[model samples]
Target chain A: MAFRLIHASDLHLGRRFANIPQPPDGNIRGRLMEARHASISRIAKVAHDRNAKHILLAGDTFDTATPSDSVVRQALTAMGENADIHWWLLPGNHDNLKDAEPLWETITRDAPANVHALADASAVELAPKIFLFPCPVAFRSSGRDLTANLMDIPATKGALRIGLAHGGVVDLPTAVLTFRPTETVAPGSIILRLATGTDVSKSAIAHIIAAAPNRIGSSMDGAVSA
Target chain B: MTLEGPGAPPTVEEVETGAFLWINTELPLLPNTDCARALEAVLPDEGRRDILIRVRATGWASLQQQADLRQAAARLGPDFAHFDFDTNMLGTTYDDADLDDIDKAGALRLAANRLKEGTESETLSAEERAVSAGALARLYAYVKEAAE
Candidate 1:
């Protein structure tokens, strides 16, 4: 069965939008913070509207492993709000599974019944003929290619397989948005990690849905394949 | 003064207390671009100054672009005595100054003063300080270039 999925990654839900130049009265920080929640809301709306059975969050759902309690609460609430959509959130480099009590753990503890935090690399059946493989980012930078194991998993008969992952690769038939929080500063020079692109301002999940059919979706320079 | 735009390079101004620059555009600070050249032309290589760059852009600059700006700033280190920029993002604005009497070089000199009160500030978190310092360096380079 051909399944529709909303693939997004690198939500960076609690990132500090620091040192940005804006009008003194403009609510850039608040707007940015709200934007994160809006991305989730948008995902829920689109998932419901598109009749998508699953929402695949490849990785980096939270900006840090130890996100504030409020952020955790808000994220879970958003997931709970969309109870009909199944959410598969994979841990990324930013929210890696190395920590004993990482953000994923907190999420799993607090998430709604519809949400599943994928901390291990594994495969599961989404529907009768739909199989899913989640490649969890175990560390910030790992020597192992997270998605390599997907090929070894024997396919179930008549199943359509989908793979989800985060990070960069040279050749992929997907559009990638890499968010580098820091840049290497040359001697006597400096650099700031400024917010740019639709990834932060708008819902890349929506962008993927709008650009679907011919496009593969990814975030933070990672790729998701159907 | 607040510089609003469809994304242009920053401009320079001298205030009564010190000098400053304002970026009112929305273009990414990509290297070898007009915005880069505009920044280069507005900053000056001169005496002690306390410059606050009020960046009001909403553009997302790529890592490569930021790295290129860093490279340019490294080339013009000695020309500047000091540098600083606002630590707040979005919702902070820079007041405009009447710089009619001041020449371009004079304005840059005043802007490129000692880098902040000190290298490290107690008000800023370590990450903020580092980010602020690097942004200041990029701003200073543009000021040096523009002021000259």
Candidate 2:
């Protein structure tokens, strides 16, 4: 049986959705702001329901590198509450490795046992035969493919190799317009873009993984569910 | 095509071929009231009309704005045939598809198909071809940006 995992990223917590007009008396506004946390809780519920032992977050867990104390505390509390699900948090462009030291420190200090920050760009086993290679973003806009070294990751026979990352997959412009490049690629791993405000449909993700029990590739693996 | 007052007589300017009414503007999106008024101004009050509104602009649209516009469109009923922001705005072009539904592999394949048609088709203008190509690229970027 394959190791069940839920991949998600670009949480962008504490983001002041400024364009969305804040209602008077701040009731709806509060709910709108708290929606991000609600989303996290929803993700946790997805993990619990799907029997996903691991929820791999590619990056940008927080909207800002140094989020407010309350935001940080709230996020940490949520992680603490969902202690059973393994959370693999990777540093992304918004939460760069070098810049967000204090925040990372706060996370490591208060985070539960299940939470793991994939700060280093190396291979680590999620299960006996399931290996995860995370290429965390060191800088905000490093003009280099973070997953360039993913192919070099030593292959373990019969092992499920999954790469967790953040940023864009296709970097070059294709006659359209100048597509902004970011460091969010893990070559061998199936790259799933989790943009801001996208409700990470747990059922869909689970279905995709369940369908491709052997390996999830860069293809229409979710067509059955789609 | 200017956005005149509500009671202003309908005056449509043809940008491309066919029965399309192109309203060239600099603003990203029309205000809710303005949008409704514009709709009323363009569409004939009685009978069926294949009203195509193409809002051409170097405009900006937020995710919320798009949602609001969509809501406005829904409320306006099926009076208009097709109402979309100009493809120039990423919000207008690649915003319809719930990219999460299709995998990167499938999207790429479909994009390839569209691109092939876009490049090979002789009847399509340079602008149409460019828009088609841009749509795919933007789609790829968006899907990858927020894939699960």
Best by lDDT: 2
Superposed by TM-score, candidate 2 places the C-alpha of residue B6 at a distance from the truth, in angstroms, of 64
lDDT tens per residue, model 1, B2-117: 11111111121211111122222222332234434544654643331212222222233332344344455455433332222212331211112211212234644354232332
lDDT of 2 by residue, B1-148 (tens): 1112111221222111112122222333432234434444544454322332344333434333344444555565345433344435533333334332334347565664566477446899978877765565555445444653
Candidate 2 chain B, which ten residues in sequence have the lowest lDDT sum?
B1-10
DockQ of the candidate models in sequence: 0.03, 0.02
Q: Candidate 2 chain A — worst ten consecutive residues by lDDT sum?
A: A206-215
With candidate 2 superimposed using the best TM-score fit, by how many Å does residue B56's alpha carbon deviate from the native? 7.8
Clash number by candidate, in order: 26, 8
Q: Which consecutive 10 residues in model 1 chain A have the weakest lDDT in total?
A: A208-217
Clashing pairs in 2: A166-A184, A192-B147, A193-B144, A193-B146, A193-B147, A194-B146, A194-B147, A195-B146
**DockQ of the two-chain complex in candidate 1:** 0.03
**How well does candidate 1 score on lDDT at residue A168?**
49
- lDDT (CA) per prediction: 0.48, 0.52
Clash number for model 2? 8
Candidate 1 lDDT at A203 equals: 18
Runs in model 2 deviating more than 4 A are A23-29, A171-226, B1-148
Candidate 1 Cα outliers beyond 4 Å, as residue runs: A22-26, A171-226, B1-148
